[model samples]
Structure formats: C-alpha cells, structure tokens
Target: MEQLKQALTSAPVLILPDPERNYVIEADASDQAVGAVLMQDQGNGLQPIAYLSKKLHGAELNYPIHDKEALAIIIAFKTWRCYLEGRKTTVYTDHCSLKYLKTQPSLSRWQVRWIDFLETHFHYDIVYKPGHKNKADALSRPAHVAAIQIEGMNPLLKGLFTHGYTIDPEIPLAEKRHLLQWDNDIAYRKGSMKIWVPNYPPLRQLLLEEYHDVLYAGHFGSNKTLTGIAKHYFWPHLAKDVQKFVTSCDTCQRMKSSKQKKAGLLQPLPVPEQPWQVVSLDFITGLPPTTSGHDAILVVIDKFSKMGHFIPTHTTAHTEETAQLFVR
Candidate 1:
C-alpha cells in the first residue's frame, strides 16, 4: 500500500485531457459542500484530469443528501463544460439513488433542470460507487465553511432590498428561521433562495416590471409572470399585483391578440310583405363581352318569396338604361 502511494505521488498529479479517450467522474457531497474529480485512463487505470469543488450557499446548504449529490454532478459538468460537452463520460456517485436519476419517475424543479442540462449537452452514465472508495469524499468534506451572505446581484437592485427592509414593517427582522440577514440584505427561506420583498410599493413594482414588463421577459401573462417573480422574491398579495400589472400593461394589450372574437351586428332586416317589396341587388361583372356589347349580369333577389332574376347588361351601362330595363 505504501509502495502504491509512493508510485502515485511521485508521478504527475493532474493530467491534460485527451480527446481520443473517455472520462470518468467521481462525485460526492457532504452537508455543506459538493466535490468532483475528473479522470481518464491514458495507459494506467484512471489518472486525475481535473478537480472541482463548490461551497454551498443559501438554501443549497439545506438540501437533502440525494439533491446535494445531484448538484455536485451538475456543478462539475458546468465547471468543465468545455472538457465534457462532446465526450462519453461515466459518473461515479456515493448516493445509490443517483444511478437511477435519469429514470426517476418524479423530480423536483431543480432536479428537472439539472437533468435537462446533463441530458442535453453530454452523453453520460451514472454508476454507484461506495463513499469510502470515492476520492471526492475528502474534497466534499471541507474543514471550514465561509459565510457568503449574497452574491452576483445587480447593485441598484440590492440597494432596493436594503431600503425596503429598513422602512417596510411587514417583514420582521432576521429573528425567524425563514428570514435571514446577509450583510446588506434580508432574505426569505423557501426551498432555494428567495429574497423577502418589503411592503414598499416602489420596490415591489420594480420587481414586477423586471419579471413581466422587461423585453427579455416577453410580457408573459399573469400566471407565468407571477411564477417567475415568486421563485426569487416574496411580498404580500404578489399574485394579485402581478395580475393587475400584466392586465394594465399597455404594450401587452397592443401587441397581443384578443382571444374573444369581434361581435357581429344582430339587427335583422324587415320581412318583406311582397316578393318585390324588399329586393337585394348585386352585379357580377368580368364576363367576355358579347357582339351586342353586353358583358355583365345584374342579379336581383326578392327577400320574402326567395325569387331571383338575372339580367344581362354592359360592363359600363348607363344608370338610366338599367333603370329603364328594371321598370320595363
């Protein structure tokens, strides 16, 4: 065993990926972190190609074991997408349930997303590897965990959360488990990370506009807009506010087609007492002109009796001539 360690350590630690060879990944997740090791067999059995580790933040730290395990694989793939995009990769996981991840009958919202990305970009297989045998186990169990309150947020928007939390009394201080204070901002705990929106109307309105009224958001209807915003923000009557905002969106009203059709006029014509009392007149032109210069047909129909008459006339016949024909 000591000779094996000496030989392995004396050799190169990390290797460059070879395009001709396939890759193997060993992934593991602890309570607060996830890690993965990418390897390939040049001539010796599975040598290390790269290593990836991510510290969990926000609601990620509270995910179940299987979800954490799944997230580890997703982060590994994302981190080394260029290395794995068009390769045949085999993944080893300590979580046995992950072997059936692709075939699982049901999945969470995030799971579906993770699976979608994996299935779309890479050709891969999941295999069950025991925790003790997995090298990633060490990397997954980091000794110290740092506190990252918030990350990768727009500066102007982050300021809004701070301002609203100060003045808006609807949300309590970070006393409750569901609510948290991360440096300059307060957040709500819903499964993943959701920021607690205050009662301030301007802040709430800005959120609604970003999720619904923005050009990239595509002016989605109330339900979709509500779902999108609710995923990352919280406020009282959020659904109702989204409904009202979408309904009043002038651009949506102008661009979107109404589902209801235009109403037709319902007034009925007066029933004729006599055959010729109420007659309808129409002209069907565009015929070949005859030797007598006649090239059109005048169609007359009586409303009450449903009687009809067809009289031939010139395409440009005088009104007096047609009137004289009708009188005769």
Candidate 2:
C-alpha cells in the first residue's frame, strides 16, 4: 500500500489521451482482483492514460488464470470504450495461451461468448508479455491500493450553506442561483466539483497561489491551470479570473515567453493621386553646421510625382516653428 502510494505520487504517470496516437492496454488478473492500465505512445514513451481495477465476485473467483486474464481485458475495454473503440489498440497479458486464443479448437461457453464479444466490439492485437515486464501487475494484486485525497467541498461553500451567506461579498449573485444547489447538506452540480469557490479576494487569491505557485502546480499556462482548478472548484467567470491571475503572475512573466502567434497581416498603404497632396516629411539631423547656421534638413517627398523638397532648419526647432515652416 505504501509502495503504491509512493509510486502514484512520485511523478505524473498518467496523462490525457490524444486521439492521433496509438493506445496500449496492459492487463493482469490475480485470484482476488483484475486490473488494467491504459497507455498511449507519445514518442517519448508509454504514458498511462488511466488505471482500472475491480474485485472478483461470484463465478469470477472460480475462473482459471486464462479466463481471468481474458476477463480483465474485456472489462478494461468496456470501461474505456470511449477512447478505445475506434482506435488501433494493442492488448498485453502475461498469459501466453491468449496469444492464439481464437485458434483454440475447443472452447467453453464463456470463452466462446468472450471471443465473440471481442471480435464484434473491438479491433485489437493480443500480445503475450512476461509478468515482470507488465507495469500494471501491481494493480492486479491486493497490495495495489493507494492513498488518494479527494478535494472536499470548498471552504466558502460550507460557510454559505451553514450561514446562508458566504464570507466573500465579491462572489456574484447569479452564480449561486445558476451554478450551485444543495442536497443532503452536500453541494452537487450537473458535472462540476463538489467544492465551491467564493469570489472573495483572499480565498480566490489563495486558490490561485496554490495552483500557480505551488511545487506540484509547476506554473503551467492559464488554460491548463484553469482546467486543473475547475476540476475541484467553481466560480462565476472563473476562466476570466484565471486569465487575469496568470497575466499578472510575476514568475510567469519573468520565466515564460509567449508562444502565441502574432495577430493580423500587414496591409500596404494606398498610393497617392497627386504630388504634394500626399507628402511625407522627415528630418535629417546631426549634420555639420552649414554657412546658413542650420544643422538639419527637412526632406519632403510627393507620393505621385516623387518630387523632393529640401528645407534647411535648426535641429532644435519646436513643433509650432516646424509647423509654420511646413506651411510656408
């Protein structure tokens, strides 16, 4: 149990699956339970997308090793059907008998049913792997239980339910009506977190700090940070707040560079119809003083005629003087 906890928390072993990448399923079965690990190859190596496990009950406990392993694959496929259904998947098991499972001349009723289900529902390649090489082996055993912390209700929500008003006055009124509801003294949403985040400055700032500056948070970009926070909390304009917080974050400003592409293409200016009507003026300064006591020249160009005018002037001429000179 301790080892499982350590393994789970040591680093990020699981990641969101990408549809463009191929998937691998590693399944194993113990006498008591069956477990499977879903993984994807992202060029770096195999990264886990999810892990599933369930205890054996009823007739499942009496199944032999071959049936148990095959059952693990079936259960795993059904559990992750959304991701596995249309993709090319490879199923790995320690049982070598499964390598040619379809070729077996004789089959039990359960085996026949399982084979039919596998052939009909999924497109997969079954491969035999040694137990020691299977990463999901520990999950199949009884010792695979790991300590996990569930984010309980947000602190601000408790205050609202108990006192009928939250401490934070800044939290919008519409959010309470639109986003939240209570049942059995516990908050529930259509598909949101049990935790509620009040728009109070202190609590909101604290939440941002925990997710942005904390060691585990890794100071990721605003979108990822908002996604992570949304999994466990909710507030009105939460995404707007996340963007504001990330934009103002000092560490992010200093360490990270912008990856966004520049907006809009350059458009050329329209050509002029006549000379002097669309003239451009520029000062050429820092020249050697001339006999006329002028150290700069104003060069004006006519757009249509390409005509040029050179006007001598003092380098330090004020705006009004320059304007008068242009008019003259």
Candidate 3:
C-alpha cells in the first residue's frame, strides 16, 4: 500500500514503447541535410529506435549567406512535418534570430506562410545549438551546391522541382512599338525647324518685351530662365502654371548634377576655454581704389564663431593710422 502511494505521489514521465520512439530532428545550412533520431522505450530498457538522414530537395542559391538563418528554420520545419507524423518533436538549429519568432513585427510572405503552417501542424519546440555541436545538420550544406549544378543541367527536372512557375510569350513588332510610344513625351529635332510664336496677347508681350531683360539680368541657365518667367509672367496670369511647366522641363533635368561637399573638421579655438578670446586678421589686397581713396579692406573674424568685421583702409596708411582704425 505504501509502495502504491509512493508511486502515485511521484512525478509522472510518459515513456514510449521503444527508446527509439522519441523524435529528435536537426537542420543545418551546409546541404539542407535533415537528420532524425526516433527513440522508443521497451519495458526491458530504452532501445535503439530508428535513425535517418536525407538531403532536402531544392538547389542552394549562390548567395546563401544572407538567407542561411531563414533556410535553417524552413528545413527544420519541413523535416518535422514530413517524418514526425503526430509525434511530439524537438528541432535544433543554430540561428539565434528564430528566438524572437513570436515578437517579430514583419516577415516576408514566405516566412508568414511558414509560420502559419508551423503553428497549425505541429506542437514542438525549437532549440538553438552552436554550429560546432550540430554536425549532422552541417553535412547537408554541400548537397545544396551539388543540387544547383544538377538542376542547371536538366530542364525537365528543374521545372518539376522549382518553387514557382514561369510563362513566356511573343508579341508583334507593331504592337510592341505602339506600347513603347504610349507614354513618351520627349521632343527631338534634327534639322532647322520653324519656331511658332503664340498669338496670345500676354504670351506675345512676355516674349517680345520681358524675355531678353530677364535672360540678361542674371545667368541664362534654363532653371534661372524658367524661374524668371514664373516670377514675372506665369505666376500672375495662370493658376498653378509654374508647377506644370517646371515639372516638364527636360533642360533642368539634364543640366543639374548633384554635388556633395565634405564638411570641414572642427578645430579647437586657440584660447580654448574663453568665448570670443581669439581672432584671425587678414587684408583684401589689390582692391580697386574706393572714392575715399582706400585700396584694401582689413578683415578680422572671431575664431570661435567666424563672425567678421571689415574696415576700409588705404594701402599707404601708416601704422599709427591703422592703429587708430583698429581702435575705432
């Protein structure tokens, strides 16, 4: 009676018929090698159940480095689904990323489907193992490379094993040309072409009276020309006219190039701790003589903030006069 009570009170562990009945699966990157060990417990003792390993279907991508962690999760799930058959299982992988599976905010469509399938079909736990300890899974990596070569040689087998479908068709030349021309707006000129001057009063007045002055007032680049036209003529007469014309300007698009200048490194001020304590002095030499007979400007800048002070002075000014200018 005491023995029965002791057995009843003790924690229970459900044991399988043969030691080989327990499912252990491993997935690795090398060759998509999936390994399984099934254990069963006999009344006599735990017995060697069944051990199986196989190269998975599919060629390895040439750049498998980025997708290694994703592939590991997929192969691990596939092996469990294929062989475990209603049995609880443990899957081991080396990818740490899978540890946050439940909390990941975004996943690719393929990953979403994989997760859904895993949640629906299996009750299992994913365990992380270091790469060196996961030897059976490591063996699968080489198979991926060989599979790729084999698929490349055989088109029929390739089609049969490929993950997605493809279609190819031909279109008539005339139809292709029409499709190519559908959205094209660019103008082309080969020889001399007649320029049409608009008969509208405002546009004519703008071209005849204002265009030359605006072009000559500053640089005649297309952007500046367009801006001048917009400010003086287009903005006053038409609603949203500047936006429409600017959007279609091919000259601006072709002429503009992006320029990035490196920033100057910050140097500590000579009088490091005090503000406005240090200054730089220089002269603007060879300046045209001013009406006051000054030929150059003395420039001084605060080293800390680079704020400038310019003072007009003559080249012939004596040191005493320069000192007076500085004092003033």
TM-score of each: 0.41, 0.42, 0.31
Comparing 1 with 3 on TM-score, the higher-scoring candidate is: 1
Q: Which parts of model 2 are misplaced by more than 4 Å?
A: 1-11, 142-328
Positional deviation of residue 83's Cα in model 1 after best superposition, in angstroms:
0.8
Local distance difference test scores for all models: 0.77, 0.75, 0.47
Write one digit per residue (lDDT tens) for candidate 3, span 202-250. 4434342232233343223434334333321221233244344444446
Residue pairs whose backbone atoms clash in candidate 1: none
lDDT, candidate 2, residue 176? 54
The lDDT, on a scale of 0 to 1, for candidate 2 is 0.75
lDDT of 1 at 312: 91
Q: Per-residue lDDT tens digits of candidate 1, residues 1-328?
A: 7986565445586677898888899998876688999999999778988878889999996686679889999999998888888899999986767888888899999999999999899999998875557889878853321111135556776787778878876656443544554544566544333467877888888777877776667788897677556534567688888999999999989999997888898998788887789888788899999898889988888898988899999778788977876776
Error of 1 at 7 (Å): 11
- Best candidate per lDDT, number? 1
